[model samples]
Target: MVSTGLEDLEQSFSSQIRNGWNARPVFVPAEFAGMRGRLGVHDVVMTVERSTGRGFESITVASIQTDEGTGRGDAATSTAEAPHDRVSLTVIGLPELGSPLPIIGIDMIALKGTLSLVALDLAPTSTSFWDDVCEKRLFALAEDARDRLVIRKRPEFAHETFSRHAIIAAARPGCEEHAFAIARNFFTLATDVVAAAMGRVGDDPIEARNRNLAWRRSERQNRKEMNALARMFGEDRARTFIDAFLFA
Candidate 1:
């Protein structure tokens, strides 16, 4: 169970993302760096290709856990108390035409003792794909932590592709009700940001076509059933189902 004191830890994480947004360099410790180095190489390549409009053909997701003493041998032995708390959601975007985009990976790191979450890295399949997925997952995670957090969408050019990140932080704790209020705020904010990011791709004719084709070809009817249910139950009900699934 997460301690109630973790509210402060959550606030600190939010502040770090805000600072990183303002300054452009979010310094992650060596532990996170190692995880990125090992797991993110493919994501970097995919992001670059997608950003260039070269297209992506396929993608995959993987879960990894690395304890202090196991993977890195002697180097990891000394830092057992400061073990890296790393979890990653890697998305590999492949273009239908030309070569496949490099893998796009987003990482979330929690400092072991502090239990404070941090944005370790947002790397795309390609150098250019940086903008494609950078702030999407980070903001989503922040929203999960608190509802009142806000993310200002700002896109810039860096490392070849256009990139943008959302600055996220919690509102004042204020009262007992504030916890739920903050959580609601984050949910709304994250949903909006994610919608905007997906809109960036879905609005594209080619991407729409790819999605339609993929959906048609998929043998599992889960997507179709979900869509039908969404239409029948409306957005709120669909959301309730999703929330239950995510939290429960």
Candidate 2:
């Protein structure tokens, strides 16, 4: 299990939440060998979602580990890790369009250890405060781990095993409201990310290709869904949704 420092961790998060609101840090299993379970702290950053006009405070963390040793020769003979930065997006919504559950995230991204100057003496921008924050997170969707732990779905909840649309569609209970609500969060966050990623270049082509490929798949599918929703739910409702869900 849980190793140590659970109490201290809870106390730290307790201070971040409102006095009356519940802010329990839940234990999440570490999937990889030797990796320890993690606790999720909600309300890490609270704010109103612009899309769908819903409210949420982003979560604390959801991290996953995968093997990254290169196999140029024997496992031991691989060259020094070609450490590079990775680009990843965290979607803050649900398991499906129809379910207001945690997101389904598959993070096999690996980073070779980097050499850096200690941050204690560094400027705020240069400090690794956010780095620690990212490290603590094991997944974008809390239920991704939750499902596997409790067998929320038979055969496990591995995102790698299914397409995004299939995952969302299968889990949907056919409720428009919940699906739209969760989708609103997804769209709102996506708009912000796209706005940020626009005109930006990655460190390399592979990074750009991987990031764009994922984006295209999601965005393309989303547009199709948006069109279908308009036909079924009326253009006015769809228009209103798109307008509210996306950022200028």
Candidate 3:
């Protein structure tokens, strides 16, 4: 189903998150269901899925597809060949408070037939959370991509939130596959981290919660993202979506 390079990466990421993590589908609220018609853009689609599993407290995978009329449409569209300017996939995995696992965050964007952006990070949710092995693997994967792809400078807010080795790239003409490789490898490493966190404990819940709150606070400050959502879904719905789905 995923023959195109960008589509292949999106499908691979979704499949890995669902099957590799044994994450099941959960209910999406009715209000968030009929979003296609709400937005007048052609084939505007927004899908949000929230699930929780053994080692995770909450796992969210959402996507949006739309033409250039609306801003920041996620790649959750069903038909990749359809007339659309952008498609994006966002994944956020929050480990259980006791697991001591870093949060898994990925945002992939495909625009005008090219894989434009690939943002992947394993963000720590606690003051004292650190994994030397994981950091080494992340840095290695990120550096390889950096050498081959066009790295994008992160926003000021993201600097403190995302890991030092996070891969934020703007894949130029022939670098889509290279970008895909880094993302795939990072995802694989994320699964390995989840597996390792299964029986681990002793993380401070208070510290984790504080870090998560701070991350969300910083994320809310992204005017570009908020403005895009507001233009696409309206001010009220965009706010609600951000609170309920995006950063919740």
Point to the candidate with the largest lDDT.
3
What TM-score goes with each of the models?
0.26, 0.23, 0.82
Candidate 2: tens digits of C-alpha lDDT, residues 92-209: 2221121111222221111122111000000011113212222123224223323422112322222332322221311221222332233233333333432333343333434333
Clashes in predicted model 2 = 9
Q: Give the range of the ten consecutive residues with the poorest summed lDDT in model 1.
A: 41-50
What TM-score quantifies how close candidate 2 is to the native fold? 0.23
Error of 2 at 185 (Å): 0.7
- 1 or 2, greater by lDDT: 1
Pairs in steric clash, model 3: 64-74, 74-87, 74-88, 75-87, 75-88
> Local error of candidate 2 at 154, Å?
11
State model 2's lDDT: 0.25
Which 10 consecutive residues of model 2 have the lowest summed lDDT? Answer: 115-124
For each candidate, the alpha-carbon lDDT, in order, equals 0.30, 0.25, 0.69
Q: Residue 82 lDDT in model 2?
A: 23
How big is the RMSD of model 3?
4.8
What is candidate 3's lDDT per residue for 1-248, written digit by digit as tens?
A: 11255456657766776788787767778777545523333556676777778577778777766544433256433334344433666788877654567878888776344666788888876535555437878888888888878888887888778878888887776657777777778888988887776676635877776776667777777776777668667888888877776677
Residue 134, model 1, lDDT = 38
